[model samples]
Target: MLIEPLLEIRDVSKTFPQPRTLLEVLARQPKRTLHALRGVSLMLRPGETLGIVGESGCGKSTLGRCLAGLHTPEGGEILWRRQPLSDIRRADRSRRIQMVFQDPYSSLNPRMTIAQMLDEVLFVHAPSMSSAERRDRTDSLLQMVGLSPGLKNRLPHAFSGGQRQRISIARALALEPEVLVADEPVSALDVSVQAQIINLLESLREKLGISIIFIAHDLNVVRHISHRVAVMYLGQIVETAATETLFGNPQHPYTQALLSAIPVPDPDIRSLQVGVQGELPDPLSPPPGCGFSTRCPFVMDKCEKPIPEFFDSGGEHHVRCIRAHSSTFSVPA
Candidate 1:
């Protein structure tokens, strides 16, 4: 039997209008809009971890926010278990999906103790619970993320970065969410702490059977944790495939370049470097056709005219480049 997606994003698009100057407004200058996400789509299966990797401004966080219901999309549909996400009640949605933000220090309340923070989540979501029950639940959440209940009374400023992140995870779990949108959860921590957080997230996924959308710029981390990976560029997904397939046999030029950038630990084995031509284009005025057309090494006349549709390279592998169908296509030296 085939299983349906737990969450689905169909042709989602989001744009932010640039703040206009008083002079520009008086002069009747056209308002410029930054296209953060353009016709992006993806699916997350139940109990699956989908990794979204891209450059700094490539809409990774924007996509995560959209999934967590933090930002409403300007276009397209986000479906939850075959139902529209907008139709879901806010309280129900919060209980089902939660977000672990990038900066643990900033995400938490500075004044509130850990217990107070967790208690707030439970108070809002599980108002039926008694005060004693809520206290017990908060302690359980702290213990669940590998923190001691004794630390619950401490302020956010007292903990280390990794410890604070674990606290953030605990707070997110207070609602018993089935899906976790982890937006660069480990990016700001120390290298050793990063591994610890990654293991914590992996362990939580296994123990709680929760699906995760892991977004980050770290390719190695994504490969280590993700079953499937999606490569985004300038508000569009250029390629997506299983972790090994995308790393082993990248089809899109942009994906190949990204994989090529991963450093080889051993100096004896030199890796082939694939360089992209130019900088990322301005989102307010993107290139006419494919977003990567200007920077792609294998660009052709046709790639500059019409936007390429996703082509199935094989099982579960999809590419959005026009050259995806070509048998002889390979990254240039």
Candidate 2:
């Protein structure tokens, strides 16, 4: 049986103008822009968690923002349930998609009590609900995220870091969104707290059956929660496959380098670790051809000619590297 995607993104691209200082502007300097996302496309199935992992400055957060309607893509189509995202009513869009930001402290308002915060969401989405009904729903939202209803009267500052994150999650759930785009939700918390939050998310997903787009730099966390993984590089998806296939049989050189860099627990293997060399190219003036060519150990003359389109190796495991087709190709350890 074929399953239709809950959401689809096709040929999406976004760019931001680079800011110039007053002196440069006065001198009539040519304006430049950062290529944040380029021809990106992906499918998200209902009730499935898709994990997007990449290095810093790779535009992971920008992609998330585009999906959540925070940034409009200059090109390409975003469809929700086969309907154009732009055509969807604003109120319906809010109820169907929600975002959980990285910093819980910064995302919440300090002046508003927890109850008031949730109440505002209900006020906008469920305006007809009576005060008593709204209060009941707010309490339910608090308890849904493992927070106590009693804490609704307190301000955000009174809670611990983990508790504050739980509140953020609760606010997102208040709208009853079908899709949740969580951009580094646990990255700012302590390591122990991160585990707690990750577990909470997993539990919530099972209970609510909501689809999630989890964006983060931590491979282990992505591996634990994501059914499939998409590795991004320089604003483009380089590889995507089932989590086990990606970890056990990585094909692209970039993916291989990332897997090799995961820290091994054995002290004997610690000294033998290897990582990718060279820094990422500047986005404002990216090099021609493949973005990973400069750092790819298996670089070829063909790689410098043009960027390769994604090709399925087998079983829908797709890769963009031209060298990925060669059975003998391998990244040096």
Candidate 3:
């Protein structure tokens, strides 16, 4: 049987106009525009976590904001269970998808206590619920995220960074959303804390049957949290595959470089950095053809023309590279 995905983002794109200086403006000129997301598409199934991994400025956060309705997409549609996301009723859509920001410190309101924060979420989505029911749900959420309900009286400033994130999670779950778009959820925490949050998110998915679109710059961390991972360079997803396949056997040159950069925790495995050298290209105006072609070590003439079709290399793995299909391109051993 075929199962329809909980969310589908189709051919989505977002472009932001760059700010111009006084001189440039006076001269009747405009600063170049930034193409944040260029035709990005993906699906999120029920009870599954899909990770989007890339470096900073790769537009992963931009994509998250768009899906969260914080930023409107310039083109294409974001569908929630086969219905257009924008056209749906606001109250109805809010229950379907929620966002958990990367930094817990800034996300929470310092003026509001934990109880107040949680109550706000409930008020927006479940206003009719009695005070007792809202309190019970909030308490349950706090405990589920490994927090204490008694701390509800404390302001966000009173808690540690990790605790604040737990509160953020509790608030996101207040609406019982089917899909959670977590943007770099643990990037701001200490290494030890990062692990705890990742584990907590993983545990919550299956228990709640909540699909998650997990965004992180760290490939290793994304690999740990996601069932499938998509590797993005600049503003485009170069490759996507099941967790094991993407790490064990990456197809795109950029994906290989990214995986190779991940440090092997074990002394048994080699600790050399096999990552690509040089700076990332400008997103304002990407290369003429393939966005990664400039950084791709295996650049070819055909690659300069245009990106090849997004092809599946058996199973659910897909890569947007000519090399994936043709022997014309091969990684040097």
The best candidate in terms of TM-score: 1
Which candidate has the highest lDDT of all? 1
Q: What does candidate 2 score in Cα RMSD to the true structure?
A: 2.2
lDDT of 3 by residue, 41-103 (tens): 888788889999988898899999898888999998899889899998877777878999988
lDDT of 1 by residue, 228-327 (tens): 9999999999899989888877888888788778876644222445678889899999987999999987789989978899999888899999888777
Candidates' C-alpha lDDT: 0.91, 0.88, 0.86
How much lDDT does candidate 2 score?
0.88
Candidate closer to the true structure by TM-score (higher is better), 1 or 3: 1
**Estimated TM-score for each candidate:** 0.96, 0.94, 0.94
TM-score of 1: 0.96
> For residue 28, what is the lDDT in candidate 3?
91
In candidate 3, residue 87 scores what lDDT?
92
Which runs in model 2 stand beyond 4 Å of their true positions?
Answer: 265-274, 326-333
